[model samples]
Target: MPAFDLPRRLVAEALGTCLLVATVVGSGVMADTLTDDTALALLGNTLATGAILVVLITVFGPMSGAHFNPAVSLVFALKRDLPRRDLGFYVAAQIAGGIAGTMAAHLMFDLPVIEVSLKARTGGSQWFSEWVATFGLVGVILAGLRFDGKAIPWLVGLYITAAYWFTASTSFANPAVALARSLTNTFSGIRPLDLPGFVIAELLGALCALALMGWLLRQPANNTYSAARHS
Candidate 1:
């Protein structure tokens, strides 16, 4: 197991989680009020999400690995960058922080119950569309992770921008993010009952990301930590 700067990691995770919820839920709620079209709401959520990912990665990558996604954290553990036992700690902190962040957003906005989630689901998308959108998201994250950390925020931003415009599902690939978004009852919400299906699709997308990274990065791919950029 690798040693971590625990205080730094926790603080970074807390800030990142808060911002993620704020961006998603805030934008979603605002967009719904600004426009009657659902497309406008999605556009707002997507743009806010992309911008936040870039900002969060730049700010928090040094302190806590900047893995706002549980799937990413788990995959990094599989790749030996993270300790197996520590997975529990990281995930617990992330989920708790995410929920807290969402709740705070709810308090701030006085959100309604129905409009508060970022979970993946069908509107016009079929299951395969959901799968492809998530795969695209994972694909972007894998590419970002396997490459220069300095480029991560921008690359991720570009990926998010692309995913939003290209995919039918609007690319909600993360469960924690979904859960936080779900808390706001805004344009980003998905029904609570539909969570399981979204989770399965996200995991599948993350698996695809791992495989794609394996083929794409193609270097011994084990415990390989190049110098990660902090800022």
Candidate 2:
């Protein structure tokens, strides 16, 4: 059980997610405004998002495990690391916080508070990319927990940094963030219509990672290991 109460944990999750989404959207808007070069803008956005993930996870991990993504929360619940009953609440808090972050970013940039994105992000290739991105993210988290738990923040941050460049979808491995991004018709936005494919792909990816990592990280029984060692 966590040292923090449910309310406190929920607050941490919401606040962390809020700040994360704000950084993602704000940096993208700022970068787009400053440059006509699409790649440069994406690079700026990626750096800000990755840097903020490290900070947020470092600060909030102790409180709520810093799960700003529903896919991640679901994985923990499946692994029995998080209470199954709290899964819904955690996901709700994350999604609400993410939307608030989008609004906060819009306010900072003098844009409308709520706008439906028309950015076309649909396609089979992009859906597959989302699956790959989320699979890698969950795998990284699970492996980091297994070895070098203290380095989880850095591991996740660096993984996302690389994923942003390698994945076609810019590694929106987070379903909450993807949903929030749909509310902003800005540089970081994805079309609301395109969300279903991404969300399904991400969820499937996380589940697959959980299954694979569970088997890979399991320890052998004492007798089995002893016999194997002796033989």
Question: Candidate 2: TM-score?
Answer: 0.97
Give the Cα lDDT of each candidate.
Answer: 0.71, 0.96
By summed lDDT, which 10 consecutive residues of candidate 1 come out lowest? Answer: 222-231
> Which lDDT tens digits does candidate 2 get at residues 151-206?
99999999999999999999999999999999999999999999999999999999
**lDDT (10s digit) by residue, model 1, range 1-231:** 224576668667767877787777777778888889987778877888889888998888877888777777777777778777767777777777777777766767776533544554654364455567667766776676667658888887778767776766566666777666656556667766666676677777777777877788777534444433332
**Number of the top lDDT candidate:** 2
Model 2 scores what on Cα lDDT?
Answer: 0.96
TM-score of 1: 0.82
